[model samples]
Target chain A: MHPAISVIFFTVTSGAGFGLMTMIGLGFPMHNGIVAAFLSYLLGGGLAVAGLLSSTFHLGHPERAWRALSQWRSSWLSREGVIAIITLLLFAVYALIWMFTGQRIAPLGWAVAAGSLLTVYATSMIYAQLKTVPNWHSKLTPFCYLAFSIASGLLLAGMIGKATLILGLPTPTIIVIALGIAWIIKSVWWRRADTIGFSQTGSNTGTATGLGHLGKVRLLEKPHSGENYLTHEMVHQIGRKHALKLRAIAYILGGIIPVIMCTFALFITPVFFLLIAAISMIIGLFAERWLFFAEAKHAVSLYY
Target chain B: MTLLPAQTNKKLGLVIDLDVCVGCHACVVNCKEWNTGGYGAPLGDVDAYGDNPSGAWLNRIHTFEVTPDDAPAQIVHFPKSCLHCEDAPCVTVCPTGASYKRSEDGIVLVDESMCIGCSLCAWACPYGAREMDPVENVMKKCTLCVDRIYNDNIPEIDRTPACVRTCPANARHFGDFADPNSNVSTMTRERGGYDLMPEMGTKPVNQYLPPRKKSRPEETTEIAPAFVPKAGEGLLGWLDRALEKLG
Candidate 1:
């Protein structure tokens, strides 16, 4: 729950990367020619790899991160790592084939698209599977992650389309709609998150300590005088006012502004508007991802 | 390997009595001392002698004030560590095969060699049982003294968890809960032992017996009368008389 910058960058950037790859694999402006196709792959692959590398910077043992892919049978994180690798490999092959041969193999492209989307799903499950943080342990979490990934990915694709003169008239509408849907999903997620923990029945301190029968159980003394890993990692206390302000910033920058920018780009000075839309969306997502970790209440905090 | 065993032969865990625990922190200290040298990595400290000292500790004693609606408030010294649940979310959540629960004894442990120190397993644990070692950057939790309990080098009587062995108030008990006749199981049944956060569905092997109610001051009988001096009762009375005569 620390809202680590490395993790936030990893999720936001990688989600966008995978999302972009999915769009490219599905032939979203990638059929425009060699330069456009190559540029699309480069941007998508760069973002994906950069995000992946950023994730490793937070690891205590980055060299041993390979071991994480072994337990895909149970662990969601393992599944995410394994799927991400497979997706990257497939995306590379698909992009190379398109760039060199200028021929889009239908089956291979579909496989790349599927792989990219599945990677995003696996990434979402990394947080959604955690019952300890009730805010994330919901069906809506995956929905929220996928929506954001797709929307951000579309924004990037729209930018590429405008620059390449391959901008389909309906593409802007689609991107705007995607952005709106992403915000709607996030709004629902925030609504549920606002009432997820402690307030929920059977998820409070009394239930956690098994002392409801005795009435109120209050912490008299903490286990340690100083901050331990648990307090440091799990006990993030974000004020409601600060959180509201961030949410507003996220909505205005990530949601409303992008929608307005995408709509304007459909007619007037298209390239600049699309680029601004994409950049604003990423910044907005960073804020959103930060709140995703900060607002979460781990069940272990009940003891403290 | 992170997958839990379908059934464990022995559910080895602890039973802490809140009534008996005096919050001495002896168990907490002994656990740290023994674990630092006995198993995996030495429990490391950061800024230990400096301002904002923090460290990884396997066991900790939390003091809580319980206020019942019908009774006065009372303090309970709660010593918490790994519960080693039958359905351990921590083990399953481990991306590497680093975290696992033994089928033989049901004690959950981390294989530090394989740990990436992602700290996901710690997040999975609802009891705040796991701690990340600052130096080794690996996950650490109570091993239930797996090194001591089976060590032929140590005396049989001392073959228990360091915390249970060092508890001065006799509040901590360790044994296989799978056996119905075991001391822990019997104590649990007789004393109304219960799990922490049963709704979490962890089905923890460890249990805690609630503190017994305290007797109110008015309910206690006053037996001894106020002191009154008798003339020839004893040396004290004679001295008092002699002093009076002199006066």
Candidate 2:
């Protein structure tokens, strides 16, 4: 499971984007009292769309992304796409309601907010349901995705607050607290993942014959000479030590630095801490996402 | 209009017995034969009689020598292919709706026409089951011989998969795993079947029974040397003395 940068960026960016949108939708009632409701809706909606556009670049065929919605009966990926579209529609309706009424519509706002969270769940289940990838098959995956969305959302919200000069400093302070908690959950997941050993017989080379033997199984002969589709797709890998260092970098930049800066902002001015946390989170999560892919041991890699 | 119902009650899978599989590669040969001729495209072999002969195969047999720390080693043959997992990664990772798992029966399959050949499904699969049909430029895998299994035109007994049908030793079984009383399920339970790479947690439906251990062979006693050299051979002793002087 060599984690491709494209997917890592897609997950983290889209996750944060969805989180921010949901928060804005949930907090729309507060928007009318503190700031221009239209402005909040526009900004939140725009950011969510932008994040989704960024994620589309990772797809091999973005045009076909629409067809992905058709298989909701069986595929989680399809469900995620379908839910994302539904969330967007709900958000749009919620915005129109807020603009005309000059107040948050309780049912619409809550529904959209819930839908946004469901989008995150669908995204997380895409990985969590995989039984072969031990690192992903755990309760922590969905929890981590949800927390990561919240953490990223808070960072974005805090920045928006600073830029708008709304809600004073307390808004960013609360966001920082949320980010800190998210970081702790991610750290625990990382520790737990490290302790689990992979089953030896699962390797493609070993299991291809269905022998549970513990003896050394090397690629005595490849089934193909040139790179077949399986070899090309599954055998891609990076060294283990490189992935370890990258994981450390991701933890520090994506997890630790954002927490520290957000905490500092709780007592200090919101502007400085918000900017630092947002930037650090984007960078750190990129690394974290990359490590997620790179450190993954695909059962297919056994053939190599 | 042919309505391939969106779902069906076919839990198609392979049941491989670890005890009997001798790593003969008969399954691999038969699988290639049946699938290449019957399906979307032929499993192309680039250099058949030349330097290299490589082609796509739904099933591959692997041989390994298993040795416990304190026990003697034994050869075990493992036949590897798609497990048709309940929670298949290949289905989720497909950007296009080409790869899908059947809700009716837990068969993870790909629609060749819908597939853009992105190869992401291959990356998602821990088992090296899915392969690109070079001729069709679409993803391909063992279908459990979907067309063959359900065809009423064929005799009921011959309706089984090509590989299962061809197995001389009856090493492979095909059935609806959803039914608890199914032969495959009962056999698996009674034999204490194990999934390949259970840690991956893909929840593959196919299970492999571990090889049954055989009793140890009788130990042979060590025999002493047949003949002792009498005071070193007379000629050899003289040569040794001469060689020592020369040194």
Candidate 3:
């Protein structure tokens, strides 16, 4: 996997947006202009749209993107697109009521929140459903996505809610818990990724050639004298040292830093500190998302 | 719509004999030549005829050296392409329904017009069957020569896939596997043909015939007569002339 920057940004930023929507919508009673104008519209909606648009950059035919939504009955990618549009529409309606009427429609707000969460789940399933790439095909994948979404969303809300809402030990405690849970889930995911791979599907060269009965199978020569689409795309062999270094960066920046910052916030209670925690966490998650794609081994690589 | 049919009327597929394969890339070249003009035409290439050349190809041949415990090392020539699986994840995962398996012939195909070329189908396929045309930015794979097989203009004998027709060693066989009496079916039964990656449960229509067991050396072996040195030739005499040439 090349881990295209467009896709990485799309996943992390859009996930944060949907997570923000879920939190703000769920807590609609705090219907200040800050929550409605800044949190919902500026932060959540802007990131979501920008991320969605960013995803199209890597497409071969961005013009044909509309056709993707038609296959919702089967494709997770299609489902994600549809859910995202619907969630965004719902948020638009909820935003209007909040801004104009100066009142919160509790039901509409909750619906937007649920739809946003579902959109994020659909995004998670885009990778989770791929059995060919066993690393992403697990229950932990969605759990990781959901946890990260909420954690990022909470920090976003925490960054803005100082004037309107109470800032104390409780919010930092919640962030610490979310950070702990997210990293724990990510660790378990890495552990399980090793156990399940292309070998589990019996797609080795011996089985590939159907010559295991004859002897051990090894590549005498590659099919092409030079690289082709399959070799270049599927056979991405990241060095162990680079992957380990990236993993450490993700854990330290994404997981440990946030926890430390939140713990520090317990005594200081500074908005600037929470803002820095949010930025650090996003950077950490950016690293994590990059590793997610870089480390994934496609079963097709077995043939190459 | 992605739900697979209970049964395809004809499981049209290829049976490759590993024993007969000489590791020549005739099938690979023939497929590229025919498909470049037949359908998915122009099989686009970038940096072609340059320092590096890369392009989309429907079929490829892989050569492997295998060494069994207590046995001699054997060279296996394996040709691979789309299996057109009964449970093709590529088709199911295509968001635009561009990737499809025919209910009539069991041949999986891609509709380039409808394809957004997200490469999701290629990701779902375990065989490395699909390739993206960088120029066209669309996914491509073996179509089982749909146009040639059904065409009325071509001669009946030549109405098979270009790969099957061009195999110099006659290793590639094409027919309907659904018909028990078909050549492909009978050959599979007699030769113990097996599916590739059965653990994935895609239920590939194509089957590979494993290499035949080698026969042991006879106990009573004929000995060759010893060579006699030429009357005028000697080791010192040969070195004298050869050394002069080297100088």
Number of the top-ranking candidate, with TM-score as the measure: 1
Residue-wise lDDT of candidate 3 within B74-120, one digit each (tens)? 78888998888988988888888788889999999888898888888
The better-scoring model by lDDT among 1 and 2 is 1
Can you write out model 2's per-residue Cα lDDT over A21-84, one digit (the tens) per residue? 7777666224453245566666666656666666566554555557666767666776788888
User: For model 1, what is the error of residue A96's alpha carbon versus the real structure, in angstroms, after optimal superposition?
Assistant: 1.1
TM-score of chain B of each: 0.88, 0.82, 0.87
What are the C-alpha RMSDs, in order, of all predicted structures?
4.0, 9.1, 6.8
- For candidate 2, write residues B133-240 as lDDT tens digits: 665666789888877887898899888888789888778888887778998989888987777766555678888877776654453333323334434668988887
Best by DockQ: 1
lDDT ranking, best first: 1, 3, 2
* Candidate 1, B132-161: lDDT as tens digits: 999999999999999999999989989999
TM-score versus the correct structure, for each prediction: 0.93, 0.71, 0.91
Residue A216, model 1: lDDT of 90
Candidate 3 differs from the real structure by a C-alpha RMSD in angstroms, to one decimal, of 6.8
Candidates' interface RMSDs, in order? 1.1, 5.4, 1.3
lDDT of 3 at A104: 66
* Candidate 2 CAPRI assessment class: incorrect
RMSD of 2: 9.1
The alpha-carbon deviation from the true structure for residue B148 of candidate 1, after best TM-score superposition, in angstroms, is: 0.4
